[model samples]
Target: MAEVVTSGAVARTVEDLSGPRGLPVVGNLPALVRGGRPHRTLEEWCDRFGPTFRMSMGRTPAVVTADPAVIARIHRQRPDDFQRSAHVSGVIDELGGHGVFTAEGDEWRRLRKMATQALNMAYLRQYFSTITLVTDRLKRRWDAAAESGRAVDVLDDLMRYTLDVTSGLAMGHDLNSLEQTGDGLHRRLPLLFPEIGRRINAPVPYRRRVRLPRDRRLDATVREIDALVRDRFAEAARRMEGGGEPANFLEALVAPLEGESPITHDEVFGNVLTMLLAGEDTTSSTAAWAVHYLAGHPEAQRRVRAEADEVLGEHAFPPDPAAVGRMKYAEAVVTEAQRLRPVAPYIATQPLHDVTFETEQGPLLVEKGTPIFSLHAYGARRDTVRFPDPEAFRPERWLEGALPPESLPFAPFGGGPRFCPGRNLAVVEATIVVATACRGFDLEPDHSAGPVGERASFTAFPVNLRVRLSARR
Candidate 1:
């Protein structure tokens, strides 16, 4: 456990940092691509080449670090010593998602303030029923599947459930994807994240030159999303004109703040898009991963079920925040799931200035404008000293207070100034869903449901993780 040494100059430049040797001009791009999930490969590399080292994707030279101290410092020094990767921001902006997540400098500050207010716990408390309503909808949907012997596509359906929750809370409307199916925003959203990842890792922006079908579909999805957001904004505006208070997130964005001019419609839309993007895949993926682990570890699942039954009593869902708060075991399971299988496994950032980043290995000089991958997932999970059995899915460990002081090194929402705004909403959504599912039904892993695989896009989601829901008899 080494601290960041900024005072003294212990030196080793990017040129001096050791990493895997690459062939010709392509560099380590093929190894990364062939490695399947980039996060896993990055972790493997971290094990091989100390904590901090260099790796290139084609001609792009980037530094990768799984050191918690280095990663925390990187996140805290945002828009100063470091910032979100320019290439990532450009990709997000081009895809119509330039909001708090991608905005830099003063723009980021402004958006962060508005975004923070909208996601405050007070708002989430007001919207507690929305979480319950969405959770119930999911329960009913799964009930139908269980009764009819239809296998549940846990990740796909969880996306719909999360979208419903976010839409009700953020847009002040019910965009239900649970009952309705095929070619809706829920279906469109899962595609958007993976595409963003593909573009980010691409050596050449070849899709721009020769449009693939996937690219065209992404274009259509963005257009539809833009239209949907505008419609919601118009409704919020109409409500404001009628002298109604700012009820939901969209209204919060549209309603003027003191000493500030009204935000542009584009900005409003961008922020709304950011909320949906932040909420959808991240929560759904985490909840899905929890389900995967629970199915395999029946004792943990049973404990979660018992806790949910006790906390929820006769109700179908947790009555309030207090009630959900009482279900310690279930929440522990969700927290463990987050630690083991984080959605955004690594953060993509760039240095704003030349600085010495101290790792357990040693102090290394990182140049200005260098792309950085702070593998926070690897930091928390891979540290055998902190987490003895890093690979095991042991929810009870979380119950036993196994994590030591300052858990931000592996916190799913991240740490420092840019911590996730939608974290409260995401955790509640996941916790409620996990509770509801385990309380009423049994998640039986299907033997014939193809190979269980994983794909790392912007968020890592379970692939072909088909689990059948059986009525708890």
Candidate 2:
């Protein structure tokens, strides 16, 4: 029997560790790319290999885990040992330093508080109508494309909708990319992140060694976005100068904090970009999968349709928060879709201090500076300890309180103090999108485009999601 080892126990040998041999500088770059469906492949390796595994990515030694008890120890019990991974923080620093997603210790606390205040349930409820408006707009576009007998890229449309919502409600700028034509700032948003994401995920030499023509274009687009953000921040500052209390997250963040560092102007710009990048696609992709699944499974579609009918009536746009809240199956569909295709698959954390933790298999040593990866997707769906028949896309699992609290089997939004602040917002947004889309039309799975492939980057987006949306009677 596997010993349930804790921090006090002797540091036992780590069991699951099967990685490819590598050179010093370019450690596993070739391997990481070669192994497509990298998440699932890594999971298979862990299953064959046990608990804690070691892998090297271009000389960076990484420790990966899928064990529930071990994940709980790092995220919950001995959380101090697990700080944001340096690699991850470096990118965040470049992108948006000292914000809720990147800041550590007191700085992290301050940003988290501000973000929590701004992104509270009340604010999210207020934005519910905006989310519905975007969803309806997207459906109309899709319906038009379908009626024209044209193949639509569901991924692109979803991106536009979420980008529009995030920019308007959170950033206080009505980019209006959801309805407008032209390859304006909004069209550039999706392209900007992926190119930067590719550069960040690449090894230093590899990232620097190769500079494509597209890099210049990507940089130019980024500059445009920065210019826009700076203008907004300046306008906000001017309004504050006029003695009027400013509104929206952009304005609120510029105000002073009690005894902590107020979010700096640089940090504000970075976080605005971060919010656009981090918050949008994850929600959109999950919503896309939910719609995909609900459409194929007519029974599930009926449930969502019933919930939307009860809550939203025959209206195209959700008029109120009460309508958003009455979406039980819609909520369940989002939950199950996340379980099936989580946007942020694996979250990496590095320990601040030396610590030890327990695992179902045995005890393990977490050195002071070791990088630890809490593979949320693997844990959420694979851990049978939490869900029965883990692979099935059954929203019913969330129906009768089937999930446990705080374990590997249950970390879609993560656990403990570092849990995602935007979880509720994501859920509500997803619910509105799924329910409203269901109400507007029926999604039929088009097998011709092939299965959805998980595109890895800073976040994962479902690729090749070619589904046909037909008008509902």
Candidate 3:
């Protein structure tokens, strides 16, 4: 029932695809900018042009798809054929070098293996105390803010919490950004990620063409970040050489220097940047959005609190990883939050070879070099057909006896080989934060201010999220 069309050297003709036609050279740019967020615009287009369509950003051709089957196929079958788009990879490589997040093929494989070993479940279990310490510090700060009876910036506080946890776990240093008041490396580090996102989505290649003021600032900030990470890596290496046990990611990376196919110092540096950038924004944004959702739904919040209290009875301060695992309802809350508000909205990939995607409409031949934007967040996770009552905040949907087949249309962490290596860590970290926060305090939205809106940076986060917290009775 599907028609296949092939032209000379190319796969499908431009007319074969359905999408918006824009002005000359800058196709779809205006629509994307006017819609504010590209993923939202793509979702609108998906509604208009079926599940799959073609659009252009400037002169670059792209295939946009909302179909879970197509997305799953692309993710599962053709991982080697599809990789990060040039623009996305270029921006990330420029900022963080060729780490696991940006690397392709064999380089990615090597870096991913090392990163996996470094942040494996065992390592995360070991690092639980570090996460607990940082989270306790965050709780203390919230306690102070609660006493003031003023709305606190939820995203900012969660960012500080994630920064402390990530820096402490990865670098073996406590930034204490939650309590510290000065503009230190911890503060400056977050600025780089958003800027990177801006550059990636910019219509004009300003970062490549000319040295803008922001570019210079990014360079300076990156230099500071690099110096701090390098020093920490060196110190970690020194400790490892002195017969000290490897305590953190840096030390874990250094410990394998004597192993076969050991990662280099430069790889260590790049991976450290990768972990910091990837770890902080995604986990913090998930936690913030989860809190926002829970604030609006008091019954759900009460359920989560009850579950936390039941699971983490006496040792709730620094919850053991095993105990944390037993908090099913809490995990369900985090999972549902992720389903509603995915941190990375779109996953961009480019085909290295000609490929044909089987769509419900037909078989579409995709040529090499065509950028494929899998609008995973809007397309799959929020698809009303896939998820009944997609807009509702229902953590029970993730509890046992809810959905049996968890594949397709539910890839919060993307899919296939490039599935987020830090998936477990992110989920565990968010679960701990949510469970601890719910058990310790009641969070209410600051109705004096307007409702929190969503913003797409490197990750999608709730913008201007201010919440009033009170100690639980």
Predictions in order: lDDT: 0.82, 0.71, 0.80
Write down the TM-score of every candidate. Answer: 0.95, 0.90, 0.94
Worst 10 residues of 1 by lDDT: 1-10
Backbone clashes for every candidate come to 0, 4, 0
How would you encode candidate 2's per-residue C-alpha lDDT over 436-462 as one tens digit per residue?
667877777776778866776667777
Which TM-score value belongs to model 1?
Answer: 0.95
Worst 10 residues of 2 by lDDT: 11-20
Considering lDDT, which of the candidate structures 2 and 3 is the better prediction for this target?
3
What tens-digit string does per-residue lDDT give for candidate 1 at 266-348? 88878887888888889999999888888888788788888888777788888788788788888778888888888888888
lDDT of 3 by residue, 78-127 (tens): 44888888778888888766698888887787777778887888888888
Segments in model 3 whose C-alpha atoms lie over 4 Å from true places: 1-15, 257-259, 379-386, 404-406
**Candidate whose TM-score is highest:** 1
Model 3 residue 283 distance off true place after TM-score fit, in angstroms: 1.0
lDDT of 1 at 181: 64
List clashing residue pairs in candidate 3: none
